[model samples]
Target: MKLTKREKLFERIENHLRITARQLVKFDTEEETLQYLIDSSRSELKCDFVGIVLKEGNYLISKVWSGSCVSISESFPIKIENCSPTFLNKSITFDKVDKDTICEFSKLLLEENILTWFTVPLKDDTNTYGFCIIGFMNYVPLLDEMNRVFEEFGKDVAVAISLSRRKEVQKNKMMGVEWISQNLTLDTEMDQIVGKLVERAGKGTNAQFACIYLYNERENCFILQTPAYGEKTRLNKILIEKNYVLKEYFPYLETPGGPQLTVPLVIDLKTIGVLHVENKGSLVFTKEDEEILELLSNHVAAMLENARLYNNEKDHKQRLHHLLDYQQALVKETVEKDTFDGIVFTLSRLFSKTVMIFDRFMRPISYELFDVAEDELHTLMELATFEVYQKKNRDLWFSVDYDRNMGVWSVNGGSDLLGYLAIDITGEEIDDFFKLSIDLARNIASIQFIKQKIVLDAKEQVKDSFITKLLVEKIEDEESIIQYANLFNWNLFHQHRVAVLSIDLLEEGTKDNILEHQAKKSLLWDQIKTRVLFYDQDILFANKEGEFILIIPIEKEKEKPKVYWAKLYEEIKKWLALEGDKSKILIGISGKTEVINDYFIMYQQAVQALNVVSHRFSNVGFAMFEELGSYTLLHHLKDSSIATLFIQKHLEPLLKYSEGKSMDLFHTLRVYLNNNGSIKETSDELYIHRSSLLYRLEKIESLLEVSLNFAEHRFDLMMAYKLYDLYYSNTALT
Candidate 1:
């Protein structure tokens, strides 16, 4: 096959135009640029086929084709190494035809007829973009005129494409800088700015959809704010693929579709987000589109940061104001008495939920719109004790949920646990309100504690004053003492015993005079109650009369009644020593009598005994009975000497034998006495032989030189024994 000059010249122009268009269109952007280049080349070359294939790394895709002879498959992927010209030429070829190259190109083109083929590498300065192919049914000879024209056109196209790309790059850079500056100055926040930026970028590149999917480094996932058309609705419906391309990459790039493009939003060299542009019209995005999207991504990254900062600042200011208000409330002195109730009320009103104040123990103090029964309060109090209180001075607010319905705020006053506040903010913003109220309540508690201390001190002083005056103004008249006793609510009707105590103040000196007297009265009262059951007794001092009155029951009106007198005397003496100074104090015990009307008799008797002991005795302190010994002595003697002598004379024989070491004699006497001097009982008690017991008794009568068998002798002996036992016990002697 031979080619005419006219045919060669046209083919040269066609090749030149295709190269020119390829350079004019950015490979990274509009795929249509390649198709347009193929169309123009096919029209001028008058060939059976012309097509442009694009290389992406080692893989080649037929980007554009124009020919009636065959249709280039869009989906078929070709390896750069397997392409015809890639194997044929290790160097540049000009106006040269080769059998292997032609055959390889023809096969790829699917041309069955004989043909000549020409292939050119789409060489840019750095690397091959792709290749151009032209096919003819007949072989053609290269003409000088056509070769010159082809060389010149190819050179011009290459320069034009390179220049066009540079121009496009500069334009994109300027637009990106302007967009960032404008976004920074706009009132829109980072999120809104990024959304709008991506949308605009999509529109600029004629994309079907756009989205700014923010990258969460912590989560290592993309978070798309505004999903492309139907994407958000389909998110749940669509299966997330392992390597799902962004929606904003290609038009008509559906499920199992054509090529797509995605640009990462890199700021500071880190991918913080992605810019997605979808071309739904079989439009694969070009390099220029990628460059523009990348520039837009930078602006989006900055805007996102700005928005985050703005939101943080706004939130910080809000928290600051809230804290300030809380602090002011804490310091305010006008705290409602029912702080818990007030908190509940305020919170319920503010947030429309029930609120409660609890102590650190989580015991609800007061509550609003809640049925807090006494038992519940107690239970809450018990729970509250376990909770920790955060100090009001510090910025610590702790919360806990005791149950589904119960929320607790552990209020504090510095490090010390004050108490807690609780509320059932079941459906409210409880967190913030509780913190504020609990702090306020803590401050209130501190102030209340101080106030209570002051009040307690004042009450103590008042009590001291009252007691001092009461003790000092002694009433002398019986009626007056009774009236004074009545003031203390003492019962005066029943028989009572008066014990007078004269306390000698310690040499170191007493405390308050009133306190000392009060202490004495208290001690006396305590002792009397502890020792005896004074069901109805009144103790009072008769100042002018100088007597202590004791009124006691006299069941049998008898003279010289001894048991009652002795008991009264001993107990009074002990009481006086315990209440007063043991070394220097006089105590007087009045006789027991049932003389209600004759109060003066008792008073006089007591006073006389006290005076007699004080004035007559040289002792620093003496009991009354010790001074007036007339009746006391007669009582002692009656139970002593006469009784002892009578027994000794009558039982002299028994006594002498007992003294002379006859053990049986003492046993005999004891048995005889226990048995009322009956010989039969005496014999039984001694477990003795009867005749032997009678013989011992006879000996006892002989030694005593008295008749023991006589009643009078028996009585005398009995009295003597009683007297001696009493005497020995008192004297602590055997």
Candidate 2:
């Protein structure tokens, strides 16, 4: 243009800026754009070196530089606050290299043979990005116009840097949106989503490191996704804390390397995971970057939560379908086949666990074992008792051992407990699915029990009617008796004893309400029946008001009748003790008989023996008619007036003579007869001196007119005393 030097310089700066602008459009990154500006400035501004240091956070980091002083400029990193005033906002020119007169920025420039140089603040109207320093090796005059032109060029550089950054930020934002739309979805696998999420977050935000930590509810810890690129120690610290606020940079997260930002993937106000990015290129994380990640995190949380719900729903549907199939199988097998074995097999197949059904007495009635050893099954069955099963409520699980847990539900038929439905769980945590399935199975089992109970109850009515006629001598026809007995698979022609069992509450036990009392009685009777049946299947039984009458056939064995009864008595007692509560169980047995007609008399004898134990023995465990010995006569004559008159005639006089006396004459007579009339033995038994016992005996003989020295008189007195002891153990002397 043939203008003055000032105009020419200004014109050259404009041309260079135009060229840089065109080049800026070609480059994409901030580094590329800044490098072009530095290169153009060094070539057109006639400088030995040019470098641009931008303010990033609180420091002025060298972004790009060109020319001969590259090593020196690259080494002299600058903090904005630590820079000398000469290298700050205003342009400063130096005539020559003078280390003593200048700041470190100029001193470093002079060391590279730069005698004349100036710095211009690369600033827009709003703020300063940083300063651009231009150094010349040879001397050059700092013309005001050239300085002004360079300053304008510096402003152009700041605008270009700002535009490039805006482009990068916009591009990253779009990339994040596209990635979220494409990858984070219900269709995506969680592993794939999380892995790509961390990598994409780091790349999109211009951060060197990124991580995604998913929370595990079961373990109550965070699980780091695979292939994570980040400071795991710092990420782990945040995870351990678990107390970070959403979408915020913790003050303590700031480090010498860079600042860190964490945004939790929250849903329903609960943090399911977190999106963490650190070292976002040389700058602190901006609110926009955080917002972008926050949006992405929120979407991820929603997707994760939705996917979880979807999967749970799918699982629930499958579980319901399985439970329905199990129920149908149970109904079909238990109702159509009329067996509990099907129930056990079905449940075992459904749950892949061991299944056992126990009758009301805790005896295993039906079982299907799966992957269980014989010894372990025995141990498990042993653990399954009314006592232990009752300790936990129905349909709930309790640990039976370290590796096994058990759940039991009572199969109830109306007011009676039919059985228990039990399942053995090994090495698995119980969930609602199992509980629901077991509950359904128990219901089906209970229904089947009720049906069986209905049929059995009809049979019981007929048996009870037949037994009543037999016991009351109503069925005198032997053919009718044999026919009825044979119907139940019983051989009544054999010699059998009638054992009348009476169960009552212990005197010391708390009195229960009527229903509770009956329930306990029913439970106790079930236990007794199970034990007795195990002993002998031919045992026939019928329930009366408060007792159970059994027709127990006497087997022809070497063991005596008393010994057999004793063993049976002990077995019943063991069953009672298994309840872990106390009760009175009294059994009265009649003498063995072969005649069917004599069954009535034998039943009477059993009743009499039971009465003796109830009244004379305070309801002791058991008594037998044959074991009663002399008491059998009393049992027969117990209701006779002659028996009463005999006891009165023998002991009434002694009772009258011993009135108000410290030494009882009637007691002395009893002791004298019990000791075989031996004076010393009688004295020892009475715990008295021989003379004192003789005096009482003489008084008794005088009152009753009995000779103590004669055997005939002693025999009469012994009979009288035996009668007295039998009828008058308590106060009433019948």
Candidate 3:
């Protein structure tokens, strides 16, 4: 049975090709097929090295390589004038004696001590797809008859590629027909279907990483999910890369880490998602794997289509079932109950369990708790982390295990999450029917919630109007103001200070009406509500003209407005600083209320304080009108005549001396005042040495004909500087 070396080599090559081809389509993706092609070729066929080079425009790009000491070019442009090897045109062999483009690449084999190499074109009758490389460590002679086997190998590759191109449409249609016959209904969950496909794609393909991205048509984005074990998938995870589809990236599958294979999930001609596979080893996905994965992805899409249809049908049935009940409940709740508490009580009795309603900000607005423990309620609250309750994260539903002697069920709204609606049933287990009922309850709750919001919104609009009218119309009658506030459910007639919170980067963050601006406002309002509610319930969260108009209660009769505002400002500022990407906020507060009817006067003072702070302390986040003192008085001045004369008398000499000078006297004076006239701070601000700033200050004091040490003189100088600022600004405008 002993055969010649040539006979043995022929038999080995033939056996390897048959074995690889038989298992080729067994792979889930092209990446698995590629890894197998190279690794199996080296091990089973006893080849020294193997690689795949794919055609890209006028270049032969080495996609992947395997084996000891082997190497390949990353890119080799085809230059017919330079006699570049066109492996795509036809496969060929190489030796040391060959004088061709193969020799340029043959040097790589030579460097690896591989003296013999052969390339087989992976092509069909019409198109040359690419080529595969097999190199030998020692020079080996090949029989002329062996070319037939190589040709057959190329045919197998061609067949695989053809299958890949067709499976997305034709094969999927057949599977769709088979799926219904086999009782695989459309009610199957899409994620479950995708997970099965992805797991198989990675494991079957022998890929290091795999990812599937389902297109969300509504969002115009793709929801990406990857094999949990795939490190590459997690490391490069994106929330939703916009405007990308699978077909666009079909031509090239190589990534920064390795060669990847992408195939589309198509059902009924609509592409739903993309399946990607990556082999950890140095190899590109093979044509066979591509074909196999295409089939796999198409099957997944068919299942997804069924799931979608099932959901639509199921939703239609539910709507039809509940139409009457929903209508009756809506009318009764709106007409008879007309309040959140009444609606909550009705829902609680209907469900035979306590239900709690959280507002959009996660605050408990209404609830009917019958037997829930306080600690248990607290635990549930803690469970609503950013990823659980926040609309931005939007985790809609979760249920605790019923067998654990405790069960907590929760669901968001039907159309959109108005708030958290949760049920407390300690001993009850949930089935499909119970889940359906809960969904129905949530839909009913959404309707009622919307109704309540409409009523509240009307009240808010009236309140906004009332606040503005009080400020502008000079509504000084305390009894009239109280009655007006009561009508809108606001108690703003009490001793409450007016504060305005302005977002500094409103235009910057929310340009073109980006949703981030609205989300930011919601988050900020929640923070404000939490802080304000901690002190007392006599506070209002409202806004007018991009500013948060807060009517905060004055807690103590003896507490100074400056001290109280300062403390509150510090606490809020600390929280604001922790907001990673949020814009800076500015707060302006007026002096505490003397009487309820002075709401207009206090609001005016708050606005005036904000203007003065913007000019005098631009870097500060919060300022009170009482603390502004002289700055506040300057803002109150209507004409610049007296202020101009005062400024000219105090610093007229210094102004004259510094006219047309490069060192700006106005900037120097402002910096000195801002720094509390400290020599070091002034020097640092002006980027000057201490001696230079000291010299300027002494000269200024001499020119002003007053000692700067006296508080009265310092006050006069500061006031004069503020007046000069006003006069200069007015003169510039004219």
Candidate 4:
């Protein structure tokens, strides 16, 4: 009555076949059928566990499990890292899984003490659903008879899973449609509607992350109508547009991390936006998820259309009237030359709250204090700046953890994000009238800011033109220069010095890098203008030839112009975080010139001084025209022989004797002259003993027939050494 191993397997296979055929037909859903398969298969194989895993987009997700497990659950996703679907789909055998090259999920089972497993691809004629897996508590061979039973089960389960997913799709679609139908109202903001859509879609479709993006034509970026991804705590502090590029609708591609599913929201024949989702727990996206996503996207489009039609029909005239009324009030206030603070104060009184105004760059320009506490105002400003950095787009929305009583809105003109207005409604209530007044105030403020910016820009342009002409030696006369200068409200007829801020940013010269460099220049310009203590002396700033030129008038109480210039240089270096040794920053200053016509000479001197920093004097960083001692003489000398003559007159004998040598004599002479004939210092400079340096200096002095101690002799020798290094580039020294 004892049965053989082959006979026992045969009986077991027959029983499993019978169970799958009968139960698969009777089960109402894929989940129910999968539970039955898991239970029946585990019993037939006497395995520890039976589970069904199917490919969902880029991940393998568990659908159902029967037996106990330790390491993993249904929530765990089989991440496809080492192997891709292309490799698995082309496996030689559908039933036998190569243990060495098993998927990540199989490895997890082995780690949990399930040493052996047999998985069959759950596939029909055209589609592979996933894998139907049975794990063992002990080692077992993958046999032919096992595949026969599991293959039948896979075919049946594939059908069940396909049908079950269709139901899931229908359920999700119906929910989205129902939600849209109930929420479509005349006054619903598109931003609010999109936020709800993302929330519901992520939950309903069981996605790890979801997003609703609308193409902001003005920004040339995809605006997140909802949270870009995940909860606020887990959201990436990076721009979403950088992660996802906008392609034509329905384009499928792989991201740097993995695959993503994109569902285009189209209205009529035009694609308006995108709905994107990635991962479902540990599982990839499924056909059901994609269908549901697309269906929801369609509903979103429909909702948008409905809202647009509603606004056009019902609120068009009212909106126009409100805008008109806002414009009239702004006109009345501005015609009276209301200051920025005055405007802010009016808005605060209208809303019966504190208000703060920021420029386009997020620098607070004005505010209405009106009983606001100092500590509270300070905290609000700090929080506002932090939130501004977190914004992916320029539009303002009071969506952070700041006070909900605060009403934050953008002051936009056309597509430009002009500025922002934040109203503190801490203890007050906001009605429709308050909201309307705020909208008008922000619009008026933006207009006023732009107007002021235009005037400043015009003045800057005039200043730049005048400076450029003066620097290029194109000024016809002092009168013309003064007339051009008067248009900018700047007095040029004062003793002034020129300072050149020279920065060479070494990076790959890409277009994006160029744009970034330009932005830095703009920011640095703004910072310099804001922080430079003008001190009753006017500063004219200009950008030319990839550098900044500052024509600063001399203060009446200054001691020496060079000391003041060097101090200013150090201050700028510290503020920009560009120390002399670590970063590439060279500042040059020209000596003071009294006449307006003589400023061109000072500008030339500053340019020459900055140029000398790259070529001469090892200790030079902050250079002045007066400090460039030998460089000025050497630079003006056009005759090469004249430079050679000076070198020969001072130390011709040493230069001749040092030829074909290590330039030891030239090195000894230069170091000796630099240390003012101090044998010990010269020894330190050359890393030689003092006695050796004294002996070398004696030999050199004997050869040149000059005393190294005399000031004129040392000066001539130093000039000769410097000139040799500059013109010959160490050829004559060697």
Candidate 5:
């Protein structure tokens, strides 16, 4: 039916809102519905301009608009009272600009050449969402009637806004679940999981600020897991310093600015971390929003915990597999390979670090450098000193460097210390798995060392037997001795000299404990053997109970054997001197020989020479059998009981008489005999008066019941003096 202009406008408003309400429910989000409503009002409802100002806390935020001035109409914020059901109970129409309508919302319409406008509260039975404003540039009749119709239309728009938001919320919930199910797997990294978690939380709750903070148990603090909306550094500092204060506001905290929701990512009654979400713009978070985020947090926490478990299991399996492979390869390499290179190479590859196998002296036996520079290796080698390792406990892994980035494990072969296994830990974190891998490697190294030691010890036994038999002349055939020496890679047929080294390792009275003494002796012997082998590895060597036998090959006969022996003696003396003054090394060398059977005789001569040096030449470190002169005779008589008695019979009388006396008669008599019984020579050599020397001589002659004038008495006394010098002399005659 045809009606007046006011009735016609009312009918048009009803018809247009009815059509727009259907389309509004079709849209999925509130923004889409709001935009369609504004567009329909401006085009079909005969309005010059239309805009929606949604209530956000105590302010009205111009959300959407449609007009020529739409760009300037959107996002205009005006401070206002909080929205309530009774706050804007009716449509308020402004026919002209006045002081009551001179606010920011009116200014926006004035800028659009809209002189007339009315704002109606967008509300339903339960809530007043905001206001819908319709404006016109010119005045019109029935403006009050049009405002009434527009008020009714605004209710439909408010209901549409609510339905669309619910639909979007449901969609986000489904999408969040789908994202967790599809994207989060055992293989997902923690960063990816946390990133997705934070993004989904923000979307599900319509939050402008969202972040996840994972707890670092080692650091005892919360580390921000994803990029946060606010100042990340400031948030982190606040969270770290005031974690308990933040925790007191668990679930949600409403402030004057806005509302904040905090939900912990809990699993099995334990909180691993927290999920935080703040409302966007001027909106406030509801209890329902808190529940949604909490649900998401639960799922994410489970996923995070599962991911951690999966990674841990995978890492353990990998480490165990690597350990098994290392063990198998170590066994195979120890059996088939001749050295430790293969083992260390495999270990370096497994750990992705530089690996080294060092001997007891901290000398690297085998090493594999993976991505290590030569200069860095040199530094590591220099830092790994014998003194450094010796100060640490053995058979355990420990940080060896000052930076605590290097680890070393001592390898032990039963009672013997084999070596060490070391790795560079810089820029890496070491877990129990890492330690376990190193422990397995060192244990394998110990086994390899023990295996090698077994072979070496057996070879040493066979070599010792062969050498003992050769030295004692038990192997009668020279050909047999030559074959035995060849077994040790020695050419016994060459011109060689035998050297007997007697080591007086300890002082006369040092340690009374036998075990400690033996241990020190063994250590010293190892040092000496290592030094000698370093000098010449091909030299034939045998270890006796009290001495070490070395058969030194003479390369050139042009130089006298004494020259070669003198050089060797100086070297040995120098090394022994380094051992300290308490230790003395006396080397006695024999003349060169071509015959293998003469080796036995050379050994005897060398021993006799060592005995002479030990007994008569207390000031000397080495001596040659050829250089012994008359002292060579003392070798046989030195061990003879008859020689000892004869020496005691002559020298004992003189020794007993000279004691407590002003002049030494034994010294005078020996000088007299050495001077060919020339009285003047004896007196001059003695640096004494001839009368004093004669008195001492007469006393010696009377004590022996003989006269110095008789040759038999002088000869017997001379022979006795020679024996006395060989057996009884402690120092050289000065």
Candidate 6:
């Protein structure tokens, strides 16, 4: 098409707009660039009423008006859709509009008598937001040269908007990168980092208020740590769930009472927590600001993660060192009968806490204090046990109410609890010093447990050795044995019974100084004599090589011989197990012999029975001479063949059936006899149904060809079973 003068003029204006866009890219701020575009366009496109009416929806608002026109608000609405086809397409147009189209533009436009208009759409690479309309009050002919200039001007205007947007984006991206770099350089201490972030971000964005809500993994919640306001700031530690709702469009948005922008602190696409910047004013946050904050949050999250790891590692190292030192101290000292006070003193010095050591029974053994009073200390100890030690959970460091005034950080070592260490951190720094100290306390508690075990084992060894030596050396004199027992601080003056047990030790060296010292210091044997004698007198009291002899005295006349023997045997076994050794113990009782002179014969008998039972049975436990009957004398005689013949003839069926796994026939026989042949009682005792017990009895009757229902037969069979057991059991020992 042949171009008119007016078309030529529009073309020149379009080219000028593009040049202006390129120039606008150099400016940093949005307002400065926008103003530059308006001034440049008006001066270049010299004409009356050369006002740049920046599009405001369906109405045009004059941003820069050149000639005389009534002052119109910058935000006046204009209906550009109906005004020009070119404006709707976000293109440039020189349209001759009639009164009908003018009226359609807007009611305000009609009232202002806007007849003709030229419009250029202001757009970037994206959709055009609005158009730049130039209104002419009177109609003018479209001269060919003018048409060219106007067309060129429209193109320039499009180029200007595109370049301006590009520059703004580039500037924002650069600033974002800088902000992230600075954020990462912040320290790992969360409060310090949060403080720095809030200060820098608030000033940079000109925000009224700012806060950094850090994620507390333990609580599984976000805590607002750094508030721009003072300590009384209502925003600190606000939970995300209590305050904000998460959304895909914008995770942060303005709420009912405030303008809030929350960006998730994300690392590796995982959202750790949210960072919130809020203002009470009506200032709307821009998209660019949100992006920048998001970028900053990313750096903050990564730094926080690193800081947490660093703190954990440092604490672990400190704990390891404390444990090593504690273990060394325990190994060097004798801790057999350490009081709770001694334990507390040791541990408190280790971790710098007021520590209390409790046994599994929840009794305080030792405690150490700084400024706390005795009653307060006792109360704190009880509180610690109730709060942390009794609980099944293994929370290492927690808070405990201290006299209702302050809360102390307590570290617990869980049930069968090794007690707790409470530090008065009322005035300490909230950093590595506090965390490391708590960790060290836990380590010391663990070491204390190990030390206690070691001390107990040592005491047991000394007692075992003392009894074994007295028995093997034939020191059967009660006075000599009593004197030897005195070496372990066991009193023999009280009414007592001597028990001898032989246990094969695991190691070559039987002498343990810790055990010996514990034996000398223990009050367990204070009122009663406990002498542990060994088998080989020449063997240098090695815990590994020989049998142990135990002498236990009962101070009470009411104590039964069998009952005391069983209790003593169990106690020894438990002590042995704690030593972590596999030494089978064969225990023998001398009955409840009270006379000091009789202890010699009783000791020989007990030792003899121990040897007999250990040699006869694969698993030997406590054996009493009084219960052995004739076998006690028979065991000393060594008549193996005669004893075997008697067992094979009378108890053959019971033995064979028991060996063949037929209802544990031996055990059934023993229980049946023990219940005095009462079928109902035996069944109840064995937890077996009555019918099953009857069947077993009937089977035994048939096998033995004896009617156990008769009193005479029952008596004969019971005696025979007892005799057979005695003969074989004793003969095996010989």
Candidate 1's displacement at residue 455, Å, is 9.1
Q: Write the per-residue lDDT of candidate 2 for residues 1-734, one digit (tens) a residue.
A: 46887777767777886677667656667888878777877777777888777676666667777787776666645555556645556566675334465665665665677677777777777667788877777887777756666677667666777777777767766777787887777766666776788877777567788887767676556666665765554544334445544334344131223477777788999888777788765566655567667767866888877776776788899889988987888888866866788878888898888888887767787889887776776676666773445664445455667767877777777666778877877765667877677778778888877777677677777877778878875556778878988889887778888888878766433354777777778767867776777677778877654557888877832358777777887888877786575777777789877777778878877876776666545435788887877778666673667766888888878776678988788877776776778899988878999888877877777788878898888777777766665555435664
Better of 3 and 4 by lDDT: 4
| Model 4 TM-score, all chains together | 0.41
By TM-score, how accurate is candidate 1?
Answer: 0.45
In model 5, the runs with Cα more than 4 Å from the true position are: 1-50, 56-60, 63-92, 95-101, 121-129, 136-171, 182-295, 369-381, 386-408, 422-426, 505-520, 556-582, 618-620, 633-645, 652-734
Compose the digit string of candidate 1's lDDT tens values, residues 34-69. 565567666766676776665554456766677744
Candidate 3 lDDT over 1-734, as tens digits, reads 89998888789889888878777766654456667778887887677778877664344566577975533554353332333456665567774236544445555555666677777778887767678888887877767776778878876766565555455445544654464345444555555555666666676556787777766676566567533326654333333444364445443442222267777777878877677887635445655456557667655677766776777678767756665465466458757765567667766775667677665545566777666656666555555434243434432444433432222333344545566666665555564555666666666667677776677678667777666666653565657657878885765645777887766554463765667767667667656555566555556766665557888777742467667666766667665564443556667788767765577667866776665555666577778877776766776676667777787787677667788987666568667877786878889879999888777777777777777667798778777766654345324312
The local lDDT score (0 to 100) that residue 687 gets in candidate 5 is: 87
The number of clashing residue pairs in each candidate reads 34, 0, 2, 4, 0, 74
Q: How should the candidates be ordered by TM-score, best one leading?
A: 5, 2, 6, 1, 3, 4
Clashing pairs in 5: none
Candidate 5 per-residue lDDT, tens place, 40-91, comes to 8788857777878776666667788777556545545656742333325667
Residue-level lDDT of model 4, residues 71-116, one tens digit each, is 5665456655643453334322323446667765655665687667
* TM-score attained by model 2: 0.70
By how many angstroms RMSD does model 5 differ from the true structure? 7.7
- Candidate topping TM-score: 5
lDDT of each: 0.52, 0.72, 0.64, 0.66, 0.72, 0.56
Where is the poorest 10-residue window by lDDT in model 1?
230-239
lDDT of 3: 0.64
Q: Give the total clashing residue pairs for model 3.
A: 2
The residue-level lDDT of candidate 3 at 55 comes to 60
Work out candidate 1's RMSD over C-alphas: 17.6
Q: Model 3, poorest ten-residue lDDT window?
A: 402-411
